[model samples]
Target: MPKVIDHDQRRKEVVDVTWQLIVEGGIEAATMREIASRAGFANGALKHYFSGKDQIIKGAYERSLNNLGDRLAAHTAGKRGIEALEMFMRFTLPIDQEDATAARVLLSFWERCAFSPEIHGGYDEHLDSWKAGYLQYLAEGRADGDVLTPTPDEQLVDEIIMLNIGATVVRVVSPDHLNAHVLEAQVTDFIARLRRAE
Candidate 1:
């Protein structure tokens, strides 16, 4: 019998290789030929799994977002009020090697979003999810009397999103300037300012 191939596994492997290339040399480095070589696929084999480079990039981007979402869910599970919000914000920061790696993959795709409506739409969807979660935790904190800030939940959500996105970019570009300690301290202080007096 001819050899049987697991298409799903091969596609995932291709995406993983693409992610590594992007992290190493930005999106430009993840060329189809290079990805196929790194992924142990023939030059044209990637077409079997992905339509082209954009599709592979989209796959890698989606995978990165999915992984981040999973981590956020795990870290915030059973936590509520300020605790949940803090965990959500901190995890979005590139405070560690893993987070930093994810940031690299995400940032590589950030530019492409401007040129691709599909990718841009996907990003918006994930961002909306993040905003909703922030709003939920903020409302919960208010109900529990943990949050005392006069700022509207929607405004706070926007601030938090901007803060995290800015921090992530800074951390990726200048890790020395925004070291893990500094990033953590910034997030802690931001959350602290919104908490009610004990």
Candidate 2:
């Protein structure tokens, strides 16, 4: 019998390798040849899994978003109110290697979005999903009387999103100015300000 291949697994392996390359050296580093070589596949073999570099990058981008979703779920599970909001905010900070990698990779994709329509569309959707998730958590806090932000829901959500993005950029580009503790404290302080007096 001829050897059987797991196509989905191979594709995931390729995406993983590509993501690592992006994390280490930005999106430009994730070329088809490099991905195939690093993924232990022949150059032509990668074409079987992905039509080209664009497809591979898209796959890797979605994988990173999915990862963010999973981490948020894990952190926010069995929690609500300010606790859940804080947990979700932690996902935006460079609290560890995983969060740092995701933020860096996302930054790279955002740059690419200016040039690639495919990346632009996918990134917009991914961003919408994140915004929706944050809104849900914030709404929960408000319903529980913990989030006392007087701003409209949409504006409050936008401010939170901007804060997280700003924090990620500062930490990723100028590490000396921000550390995990500082990031966590910033989030905690923000949530504290949102609390309503009993």
Candidate 3:
């Protein structure tokens, strides 16, 4: 037999290398040649996996979003209402090295989204998904009487999503200003302000 390859695994490996490059040195560093070399593939081999660097970048970004979604799903499983929502938000905070790396990679992609319509479209889809998730959680909290901000459902959903994204970006850029405790406190206060008065 010649050689069997797990195409999905190979593509993921390439994407991992691309993410490493971006996390270490921004999107500009993730050239196809560098990605192939770092991924232990010939230059031409990367083309077989991805048409070009842009495709690789997009793949890496989508991978990041998928990873985040997986983690959030894990955290939110078997939980509902405010507890699940809080858990999901906590996972997004960049308190540790792994989260910081994720935040950096995501921020780097945000810049690319400005110019790449493909990336922008993917980002829009990812963002829309997040907003929808938030809406679900918000509705759950309302049903359970855990949320009482009196804000419009759509408005609350948008605010929550914006707050999480803004905090992630700020934590990535100035972690010292938003330490783990600070992040927790910020979220806690935000959530508390949504509670109905006794």
Candidate 4:
């Protein structure tokens, strides 16, 4: 019998290789052939799991988002409101490697969207999903009195989401060049503004 490798594991392995390539040599290094070579798989192996560059791009986007989502879900378990809010914020930090990798790859994919409308839509959906996580934290805070802001105007939430993502790009690619702590504090300040009055 041929090797019975678990498809999911191989997919994760390829993605993990692609993630490293992106961080080390930019997204261009993640070209199918390069990624396949780095992963020790045939040039076409990626196709078995993805349709083409666009699909891999979308899969990378999904993979990166899931990395954060899975962590946020774990952090929020059995927690509520600000507690969950704090945990969610921590996952966005660049202090951790997987989080950093996810952030870097995500921004790379965002840039890729400029060339492909399909990836553009996928990127938007991925972003919206993240915003939903933040919204969940904000809504939970609102219900628990931790969010004192007046229903958090849509623009503000959008700004927060954009700002965090922007900062993530900076922190991921150039840690020595940017301070993750400053961005974290910026987010914390916003969250604090949402807390109930004394």
Candidate 5:
């Protein structure tokens, strides 16, 4: 008998391929043919898993969100409050090449949103989930009295999120132009202001 493929696994395989195609070749190079070729599948094989390109792209967007969420969960395991916040930030900011590729693919997904409402909606949901989790983290830190900064500025924390995203984008576009050491210091200091006396 022919090998039976796991449907969900195959779907993710297609999305994983979609991610690589976009990352290595940019949006234009992510045509269906390219994805299939790069994925080492026959032409139109992706269709068995996805109805269209947007379907797969949306899946990849969710995968990316889950990817970050998983990393943050692992990084912040057994931690809480200010430490949790720092761990979250550390998982987000580009400290190495592997992290940078994930960051870069994410930015590319944002640009893809401009052209597809499906993608835009998917991206928005993922971002809102992240932001909501962020708000909760801040609120919990404050309640725990472990929040180090002067109380907490909700707007400022949101700005910090933006700063993180913007900085990572720069690293993606101009790898040589970005200094991880500088970014690390800036981010660490920013989080430092949020700590309470131990």
Candidate 6:
């Protein structure tokens, strides 16, 4: 019998290799030839799994988003109101090496998004999911009397999202300036300010 191949597994392996390349050297480093070689596949083998480099990059980007989502779920499980929101925000930050690696890969995709409609669409989808989650948590906090901010939930979501993105960039680009401890303190203060005053 001819050798059997696990297409999905091969595709995932290709994406993983590509992700590492991008993380180490930005998106430019994830060339098709390099990915295939790194993945132990013959030249042009990637075409079987992805249309081209763009799709592979998209796969890596989606994987990063999925990883973060899983982390968020685990961190926020059984939590509610301010607690859930804090966990959500904290996990979103690049406070640890793993989170920072994901952030760096995401930043690479952000640059591609300006030129790739598919990547831009994926980015928008991820942002929408995050916004929905933020609104849900904010509503829950309001119901539980944990949040007393007069600001509209939408506005607060925007601020929180901006802060997360900005902080991720700063953390990745200037770790010494915004180290993990500083990030944790900043998030704590931000969340505390959202709660009702005693």
Could you give the C-alpha RMSD of every candidate to the true structure, in order shown?
1.8, 2.1, 1.9, 2.8, 2.7, 1.5
The sequence of per-residue lDDT tens digits that candidate 1 reaches over residues 3-113 is 999999999999999999999998989988899999998779888898878788989998888898899889999999888999988898888999898888888788788
Question: Predicted candidate 6: what Cα RMSD to the true structure?
Answer: 1.5
- What range of 10 consecutive residues in model 6 has the weakest lDDT sum? 189-198
Clashing pairs in 1: none
Task: Rank the models by lDDT, top first.
Answer: 6, 1, 3, 2, 5, 4
Candidate that scores best on TM-score? 6
> What TM-score does model 3 achieve against the real structure?
0.90
TM-score of each: 0.94, 0.89, 0.90, 0.82, 0.86, 0.95
Best by lDDT: 6
lDDT of 1: 0.87
**For candidate 4, what is the lDDT?**
0.73
List ranges where model 6 is wrong by over 4 Å: none
Candidate 3 lowest-lDDT run of ten: 189-198
lDDT of 2 at 153: 65
Q: Output the TM-score of candidate 1.
A: 0.94
Between candidates 1 and 3, the one scoring higher on TM-score is 1
Badly placed stretches (over 4 Å) of model 2 are 196-198
Error of 3 at 77 (Å): 1.4
lDDT of each: 0.87, 0.80, 0.82, 0.73, 0.76, 0.88
The TM-score obtained by model 6 is 0.95
lDDT assessment of candidate 5: 0.76
lDDT of 1 at 136: 90
Q: Which stretches of candidate 5 lie over 4 Å from their true place?
A: 1-3, 148-152, 196-198
Collision pairs in model 5: 148-195, 148-196, 149-194
lDDT of 3 at 195: 92
What is candidate 6's lDDT per residue for 46-127, written digit by digit as tens?
A: 8888997789999999899889889888999999888899999989989899998998888888888999996799789889
Clashes of each: 0, 0, 0, 1, 3, 0
Off-target runs (Cα >4 Å) in candidate 3 are none
